[model samples]
Each structure stands twice: as C-alpha cells, then as structure tokens.
Target: MKKKKIAICHYRVGGTDGVSLEIEKRKQILEKHGCEVKLIAGSRSKGADYAIDELEWDQGVVPIIKENGFVYFNRKDLEDDELKRKMNKISDRILNKLDEIQRIEKFDAVLIHNIFSFGSHLAAAKPFAKWVEKHKLPCIATHHDFYWERNEFDIVRNEYVRNYMKKFMPPKSKYIEHITINSLARRELKKRFNIDSYILPDIFNFNQKPWKKDSFNKDPLKELKIKSTDIIVLQATRVLPRKGVELAMDFTKTLQKKIDELKSKKLYNGKKINADPNVILLIAGYTEDMDHDYLLKIKAKAFDDKIHIKFISNVIKANRAYRQRIKIYSLWDIYVHADIVTFPSIWEGWGNQFIEAIFAKKPIVVFEYPVFKEDIKREGYNIISLGDELETLENGLHKAPQENIQKAVQKSIRWLIDKNLNKKLEENFAIGKKYHGYKILEDFLVKKLGL
Candidate 1:
C-alpha cells in the first residue's frame, strides 16, 4: 500500500503561530498513522519534509511598496494600487510554487491554514483552492480566521479580494474538507457557505518534554534585570491590540496587593505559608504593532496604577538561536520560564497560548474570547478560565489546595508532564503520533487522500 502525499500550506509557519502550531501537531499525529507530508507555505516550518514558496505577505516586496511591512491597519481606508500589487505578488509566488510542485512533488492532498480566511494573499490561495478542486485531491482548510470575521479585511475590499472571498469561497471552498479552530468561525463558515467543517480545536505536544531552557532557566530573573524576589507573571504573546495586555497589568496589581496582604499575615520570625514574591508583571511579547499613542496609553495605565512592567521585547527575537544578533527570544522561551501566563485576548480566531500553556503544562489565565467558548471550553481540560472580568484570576493566583480550582490546574499541567494521567499518555501518544505525528505522511496517503 503506497502512502499519500500531503501538503500543509500557510504563512510564517516557523514561529509560534496558531496555524503552524496546529499544523505541526496535526502533521505529527498523521505521520504516526502513515502519511508522507509536504509543506507549501509562505514561510518555512521546522518539521516539514519539503518547503514551498514563501507566502505573498511574507515577501518584503509587497509590504515595502505600501506600509513598509507594518502590522494591521488603522481604518477601512483601502489603497487600491498597494493592495493589487500585494495580490499580484501572492498570486505569482503561489502559481510559481504550484507549477514547480506539479513538475515534481505530485501531491495527494493539501491542507490549507488561514489562507481563505485572510485573503490579502487571496490570489495565491484561491488559485490553489481551484487547483485542489480541479484535481479532486483530498484537501482540508484548517481555518483560523475567515474574511468576514477579521478586522483586517476592512482595509481589503477591492475587486481582486472581493472575487475570491465572496465568489471563490462558496464555489471552491465546498470542494475541500473544511475545519476551523473555534465554534464562532465554524458557525459563520456554515451560515455563509453551507460548508460542513470539522471543529479540530488547537492542541499542544503534551508528549514532548517541557521546554524549560537547559541552563538559561537557572536565573531568567537575573538575566532579564528582574529581581529574584519578583513574582514573574508573563503575558506571552505578540504585542498586538487584541491581546488585552492592559488587563494583565490590572491583574498584576490585584496580585501585588494580595501578596502584600499575605506578607502582613505572617508572624514575626515565623515561616510564611508563601512569601510575597515582590510581584513584577513582565509583558513578554514583540511590540511590533504598538503605535506611539497605544504605547503611551499602556504606560499611562501602568503609571496610574503604579505597575512596573519590564518590556522583554528587546531580548525576544523572531527566531531561536538568538541567531540574528538581536538578543531575540521567542515567546515560547518566556512561557517555559514564567511563573504564570496571562492570556487576556479580546478576540482570537484560535488561542495559541492555551495550547502552549497546556503543552508547557504551566498554570495559565485565559481571557474570554469567542474561541474559548466555541472551541476549548468543552475540551474537558483544566485551565484557569478568564471568562469575563477576571473570574478565575484571583483564585488561580492565590488559592491552592482548593478543590475545583486547584484540582483543575493540577490536572492540566500534570497531564503535560505525566504520561499516566489518562489511559496512559500512550493512547494520547498513539493518537498524536498516528494522526498528527510519526505517521503523518502515511495516514493521508491511503486513508485520507488515496495516494
């Protein structure tokens, strides 16, 4: 029985992104079940067997002629020339890559991530969708964000985009297996296109060892100029508007006050139950999208509340190895070192931190987003759900040995480290290794794609 050839497509796959993370986990799962995996993406992913053209948006040329590679837009102001050029770059890149692949690496199936949802690079993605349709190749679109739902789409409403998003989607999208990360996305996909998609929520590599830096973990506080006594609560994400970084500071203030109270309760010369670890809320994310006013606003909030937030972006780089001489570190590195993760996102197509926290098995506080209610809340895992207004925030920070809260946090972190939590990490391992891991190249080969 010959195996199937699968191509997972997306942009900027290497770093910590929801689409890439899910694709990596899923690829690992499928490989174990026997699938030969190929990658057709805008960026390079570590575990991929083959690399395709860089996504159109990732190319420097597109952004240089317009916003000079900035993130997100300020309004619905559409720049027709800039957008058309962007679309052209994306189309050419994908068409060239597809042509090359057709000449050589014949694919059995294609798995797309966020391409249809973010149509900036639609010229490329839409054509690929059409190719998949024409060839009758088994394919899946693991949607993280859809066009209608994204705020960015307000800036992209030209003919080049409107055609693919409104027209191409219904006609071509229905041909592939549609999957989305959150219920809201799924419902919208169905409501708009009548496409029945599998709700494959995001997952982490629970089977792998926790990502605590070997020697670097010894004194992250010292290296980051943080005091030893500082309680390191981290907001592990890219510096973007939706992450709600302001809430993390507010939460930190509450925790800091609580710490002072705990210290006061201790008797003279007595052993304290828990020492007040001089609370310090360090926001560890890339400050790419922060404008002067936004940064000023956050600083003002902290100033008003007297919260000290050490910006870790200077040290956090885009890639590992700090290879770029930029003292750069990834958000994942911060996750492994932090005492707690503060993920207060206003909106996310899918929450990457939830899975990263789960995989790292760290105690996390996730702010309520539609994805939280739509995708992960029902997953029977234990996370400090920040549903609305810091519901579990105070409790998860201080309350230990309690039944509901303590037990749940313990279960999630424990599940990451202890393979024996359920019927054995073996079942989880086999499932992951089968459907998304070792046999990824094989599973889709015969069963999913008939390669």
Candidate 2:
C-alpha cells in the first residue's frame, strides 16, 4: 500500500516557538504512522523541506503589503489601487510556488499552521485558501491564534484588507477542516464565524528519553554561571508581554526573602538553606521584535528588586547544536538543570510550557490563564498556582496578589525541601503522558486523516 503524502505548512519553521515545536511533533508522529511528511514554510532556521520565499511575511513585498494593509495606508507610498496590485502579485507568486510543489510532490493532504488565522501575513492567506480550493485538497487549518485575539491586528487601516481577511483568513470550504488548540478558541471560532472546529490540545512526547546531564548538556549550570546550591527557576516561554515574566520576578524576590528568613533550616531535599541562597530566574526563550522593550522593563524591575535574573536565549535553541563553535543547548537541556518552572502567561491560546514542565518533571508555578482554567486544570495535576486574577501595574506589567505570591512561594519551598519531590513529579509526568502523549495525537490523526 502506498503511504499518504502530507504537507505541513507554516510561516516559519525550525524555531523555538510553540507552533514550530508542535509542527515538529506532528511531523514525527505522522511519519511514525507511515505518512510521508513534507515541511513547507516561508523561512526556517533549519529543517524545512520546502522554503518558499514568497510565503514568508518579512520577505520581498510582503512587509509593504502588511504595512499598507494593517499598519497604515500611506497613499504617498502606494495608492489603494497599487496596493491591491502588489497584494495580488505576491499572492500569485505564493500560489504559483505552492502549485508547482503540489504538482511535483502530489501531497494527499495539507496541514496549515496559523496562516489563515493570524493577521500578520495577510497576502499568504488568500493564496493558500485558493490553492486548496483549486486542487480540492483535504486541508486542516490548525489555528494557533486568531486576529481578533491580538491587539495589534484588532484594527485594519485598509477596508479591502479587512474584507480579505474576513473571507480568506480561514475560508469557508468543504475540503477544509478547522482545529483549535483549546476549547475557548473553538467556542470563539464558532461564536465569531459560526464555524465549528475540533479541539486538539498541545501535546508532548512524554515517552522520549528523559532529559539528563549528558556530556553535551552536562554543565548548563556552569555555562549560565549558576551555583549548585542555588535554586534555578526557569521561565521557558518567549519574552513576550503576555507571558507575565514580571510576575515570575516578583515571586522570585518574595521567595528569596523567605529563603533569607529560613537561613540554616534544612530544605525538603536535606540541603541546608544558606544565608544568601540565590534564586536565579533563568529566561531561556528568545525575545520577539515587539517585546524587546518588554524584556528591558522586566530587567529594570529585577534590578530594582535586587533579584538575580539571567537572560540566556543566546545559549538556548530549539535543538542542541553547535553555533560558531559554541555549544548551544536545547530547551530540554536547560530544563534538566531547572529546579522549578514558571508559567505566568496572562493569555495563551494554549499552554505549551506548562506541558513542557510536566514532561520535564519539574514543579511549576502557573497563573491559571483562561485556557488553563477551561481545558487543563480539571486534569488534576498538582502545581503552585498564582491565582487567575491579575493586578495591572502603572508600568503596564501584571502582578499576582501579594498573598498569592507568598502562598505559592511557601508551597515551592515546601516542595523544594520535600524528600518525595520525585513522587510529585512522577505523578505529573504520568498524567501528562496519559492525556497528552504522542498516542493521543496518533489516534486523532488516524481518525481525522484515515491513515
């Protein structure tokens, strides 16, 4: 029997972002199930089978289209008529490239990630919708995010651009099936467009070899200049405003004070708490272009509070590899050295880092974002909660209540000192494996694609 050929499409692939990680997992699972998978992307740092330049948002004329369509309609740079002309030209190029690839590869199905739902690359959406329509191909539009959910895309400068997004950004078609990462998004998709979608939660391969102190990843602590006695609290998500990294800093500061008070007391693991035991918050994810200033603000707060925070995105990548003779560590490698993981995102389509912490078998301090409340919390995994409500600061950062932060800090200290810490971690790993392991994804794909 001939295997089914499937193409997984995205704006960018082979990055440390959640979407890229999810795509990689799906690709691996699909291949394991006897499907020949092809990765199609606009740009990729590595591992894309087909890199179509026109499909990327920042390349060639796509940025101009983005600016004129969503940012501002500066008539002096390009009139409305000319803007449409350029949009069509770029769309045509993308369509032509996709058509050429389809003719050669003859993909049985296309799994698109974020092109139709996200508003960033407006031109690519129409071409993909058209390509699927033309070929009558079975397309699964996996929406990681929607335009209306993002503040940047809430307003459109061009009327034509708005209408185009309404029609083609997730076009209505019989060949296309929509999937959301959470129940909240599925409900929103239905409420907004009357389009029902399947909920495919973010999953992990919990059965993979456990991340341990291998020779390549043996000294992440030394590389990051962290002491063996210090508690390493990792914030593994990208440095975005919504990630609520400031809350992690706040929790760290409070936890540090408690550590100071408990000097000479034995920790749960039988290590004596030093008078000045460091609680370093290591941020392992790269900062996006829009969130550079947000990172600066986080740094400023850390400085004011005298909290030790290390920004090590330069040393962490999606996978372990050498860059410029320096050994770059994978996110999992960093996880191996972490004592606790902080996931305080105010909003998320789904929590990837939360699942990652579970797989890593580290205790997590979570903020209970809406999706978590709706789709995840019922699973009964034990985690230190930062509560659901947030208080907005004058600097525009968010904070958990003082009591909640203190409560979480106390729980973390208890967990850190507990001799049975491994037991709790084992429970989390078991629950994650039971619900969100690769088997779950395999079952879904086998049913959805009839593989």
Candidate 3:
C-alpha cells in the first residue's frame, strides 16, 4: 500500500498535555510505519507543518470567543447577530489557511484532534465541518475529551451557542471515523450524538530506553530544597479540580505520620529510615489552565497542614531544554526522582499519567475513578487503590481514608526494599506494554489505514 499522507489537526500540540503527548507518540509510530504525518496546530512548535497565530485557543480566537460568551462561567448576555458575524469572520480566516495547506500537501486524510470534541472553539469546528463537507475530505476525529463531560462548559446556555454545538461539534460525514480515548467516552458519544466511535486508549513508547537519574538531572532534589533523606511522592497530573490533588496532599500527610512512627525500623537492605523524613509532594505540571483561586486554595491547604509540597512545574517540560543556561528538566527527569507516583484523579480520559507512572517503573497510588473501575482496574496491575467513593468536606475539599494512605506507605516501603524489584518492575512493564504501548498503536493504525 502507498504511504498515506496524513495531517494531524488540533488547537494546540507539542505540549505536555495528554492530547499533545498522544499526538507526538502517534506521529512517531505513523512515520515509523511508512506514513507521512503533517502536524497542523494553532501554536508554533518544532514539529508542526502549519502554525497559524489565529488558530490558538487563547489568542487569535480570544475576542471572538469572548463575544460568543464561551470561555467564562459568568458570560455576558448573548448578542446572536454579532456573535455569528465574528464567528464567520474568524472561521473564514482559519479555513483559508487550512485550504492552502491542503492544496499543497494533498493529505489523504485529515485527523481532527479535540477541536470537535472540546467546545472552546466552535468557530473553528463549524468552518472545518463546512470545508470537509464541501470538499468531501476523508477524515478521522480523535477525541481526548468531550465538552459535555466538562462542567466549565455548562455555562454556555445561550440558544445560539447551543445551535452551534448541535450542528458542528464532531461534524457528521460518511468518510469520517470517530475515535475516543476511553470506552466511557465512546459510550457517551454514542448516547449523546448517536455516533459510534472506536476506543483508542492512550499509548506510550514502552520499547524506549528507561529514563534514569543522569548527570543532567541528578541534583533536582537539591534544587527542590529537599533533603537527601526526603521521600518524593509525585503527583504527575495537572492541577485541576477533577485531578483530586488535595487528596494527594492528604495522603502525603498520612504517609508522613506513618513513616515517622516506623522511623526506628531498619529495612531489609540494612538502611535506617529517617524519623523526620521530609515527605515532599512534587507536583510537576503547568497550572495555567486551572483557576487562580484553585491553586491558591491548594497552596493554603498545604501550608496549613505543614506539608512539604513543591509546585515544580515551572522547571519541567515535555523535553529537556535550557533557559538562560539553567537546566529545564523534562517530565521524565521528575519521574526519575520520584519514589512513588500519586494519581488521585477522580476522572481521566484514559489516565495518561497513570500509564506514564507505569512506564517509569514506579509504584503508584491511584484513585479508582469510574473509568478505571470500568476499564483499567480489571487488567490487574499492582497499585495502592483508593476506592471510588470520596468524602467531600463543606469547603469542597476531597479526601481518602487515613488507612488507605498508611497502606500505600507500607507498600511503597516494601517495593523499595524488595530484593526482586527489577522482576516486579519488569512484570508491570510487560502488562503496560501489552495494553498501552506503541506496538499496539502501530498495529491498530496499520490495519485502520491499510498501510
């Protein structure tokens, strides 16, 4: 079969976000299997084929989206006439760029990522639908998340907004294939739009070399102002409300107490545990997408509890880069220093961080969110499980039981000291690779595209 020339389109790519990460991996696998993958996104980055300023989620469409009253919860009263005009104006500009690229590239299929699923940019989605409809473009719509699944988008109550969503979100086409990141999302898409979608779980490169604490990243703990004896518990998810990051703080507190109590005990490896081990919760992701008050509240909570939590996302990126001669570590650098990965998310598309933790060969503490219980937990990897139910306080803070946290600490210690640590890590790696690795993705794409 001839190599398919494919264009991957999304609002943003080349970031540490789940969708962007998945695109990078997909592009690698597609290129490896004799497909030419052109990346088309709003933001300019290294691997992009086209990066138009106007296509950005925050910038070019800002005024247009604000006029449509889509980005905020307390939106201004709708002016339908003006909103339509602005939408079309932006839509035409975006379409012009896309058409120019299509003419030159002659892509066999355009894989639209998240633009149709996320409701933040209906102007782009509507124009995309119209263009594809008119030109009869073969396309695949891969969704990391849906707008309806997010509570933030519920504020779009205007009739005009509703009409736009109903008409253009995930444009219907005979030549388009729909893909969802999880089974629950696939089911919901079918229920809401009567649209069937293939369940494509997020993928990782399990065959790649393991990330180690190299000379470049050996002293991040020192940089974080953490003692050598401190135990690093990493919350690798973004600081979002649904991420249940407060639960991670709570778990840290509980684990710290247990560690103190058992400080005198010697491990099987003949190492004495520190009585005052500073349990540092290193959060390593950007918080720009979250509400400002949410970050403030989390910081305030950590301070009140006297928890050693560091928001080190500023120093972390998708890949290692240098800023002013100072080292900007990759997410893998943080993972190398992590003693245990805490994934206390109440919801996830397919839990990219969870898969990442597995790839890092670290013990994980995961909250049994709905999708995990329905799709992931059954696969049976060894993890400290926080059950589905959460107790919410009056202040909207969430918590798991102290017992679960203690159990996690005990399990983490055991894993750390076990003589057969490599054996256990190898077993987990095998399971992760079988379920969520690049080889699986390669086969799926090869079959799907008849490559």
lDDT of 1 by residue, 147-216 (tens): 5665545554446555555765534444577777667877888888777777665555555665776564
Q: Which stretches in model 2 have alpha-carbon errors above 4 Å?
A: 59-64, 71-79, 261-275
Q: Residue by residue across 237-280, what tens digits does model 3's lDDT show?
A: 88877889998998888777767654655433333557677678
* lDDT preference between candidates 1 and 2, better one: 2
Per-residue lDDT over 18-130 for candidate 2, one digit per residue giving the tens place of the 0 to 100 score: 99999999999899889999999976447889888887776678777776776533424767888889989888988999999999999999999999898768888989999
Q: Which regions of candidate 3 deviate over 4 angstroms?
A: 1-3, 44-47, 60-72, 261-275, 410-423
TM-score per candidate: 0.72, 0.94, 0.92
What C-alpha lDDT values do all the predictions have?
0.59, 0.87, 0.80
RMSD of each: 7.6, 2.2, 2.6
